[model samples]
Target: MSSILHVELAAEPAAAGRSRRVTGRWLTSLCGAEQPCATAQDLVLAVNEAVSNSAEHAYRGDPSGVVVLHGTADGPRVELEVSDHGRWRDPPADNGFRGRGLDMIEAVAEDVRVERGPRGTTVTFCGTLGQCSGTCEP
Candidate 1:
């Protein structure tokens, strides 16, 4: 069986937290567990980073921009995509504490893909629950 969730909201700093909360809830229900396990928790963190990046860099000076988060859980596999309609912006030079979102996402997710075009930017993250040591089971 498969389960899916979609969320669309203004591209603001708050969107990241909202996406995390919604994704966490959806994952828990989809996994049929009281709460997501360690691997699933890592996936939620990746989802937060993706939405946070879009909220911070995608819109630049435009507060009217929006972000879309879509996720699916199929068997032991999970996939999430976060997209924005604004142009993509390269991460700024590190100040010692910044520019680590993409790196963190790549570290936690089993597979990651990013696409950018005139229409928008989309980041996809995929991971398998079974990759963890029996933590995903309810």
Candidate 2:
């Protein structure tokens, strides 16, 4: 079985929390009664990092910008894409306190891809559902 979800929100710091909540609910529904806590945590963390990066760096703290999140659950795996419409910016200096979002995302997600172009940056991540190793038929 397959399930999908999409969401778009203002590129504001506050939107990050809202995005996490929405995504978590959707994931729970798609995963059915399996309750894959670890997978859910990883997916939420990855999505939050991607969204936060757009709100903080892409728009440079401009809440007027926008962030788009797309999710797909195919069989035993789930994929998520988070995109922004603003230009991409380099991470902060090593000594900076907030340059580790990408690193944290990479650590949690099974696969991570980042693309940047004139229009903006997009992050795509995927991982297998904890309770559905071969298929997510429920």
Candidate 3:
């Protein structure tokens, strides 16, 4: 069986934390066990980064932007997509202590896709739910 989690929140600073908490709970329930899936923490971390990115950069100075978080788990695979309707922002040239979110997401997820257009941006992260197989390296 497959399970889905969907949440839409204003693109604000606190949205990241809210998304993380909701995702954690959804993962725990989806696992159907006392503890969440083995990779749940990593998944949540990656998701937080995505939501944070949207909350920080998507709307620019506008506060009316909306960010959507959608997740699905089926069998051994889990996929999440974080999207925003606001215009995309180019990363600053001198990102001294930031701009590592995409790299971090790529590290944890087996597959990552980012789409940007007039409509907005959507970042998708996909990975296995349990222990890594031959495809994943420690």
Best by lDDT: 1
Q: Give a tens-digit lDDT track for model 3, residues 1-138.
A: 248888998999999999989987876666554555547767888899999999999898688999999999886677999999888778889989999999899987768999999999999998665443312222
* lDDT for each residue of candidate 2 in 9-47, tens digit (9 for 90 to 100): 898888799889988877766666445366776789999
Determine which window of 10 residues in candidate 3 has minimal summed lDDT.
Answer: 129-138
CA error at residue 78 for candidate 1, angstroms? 1.0
Q: For each candidate, how many residue pairs have backbone atoms clashing (under 3 Å)?
A: 0, 0, 0
The local distance difference test score of each candidate is 0.84, 0.81, 0.82
Better of 1 and 2 by TM-score: 1
Per-model TM values vs. the true structure: 0.89, 0.87, 0.87
Candidate 2, residue 112: the lDDT equals: 92
Name the weakest run of 10 consecutive residues (lDDT summed) in model 1.
129-138
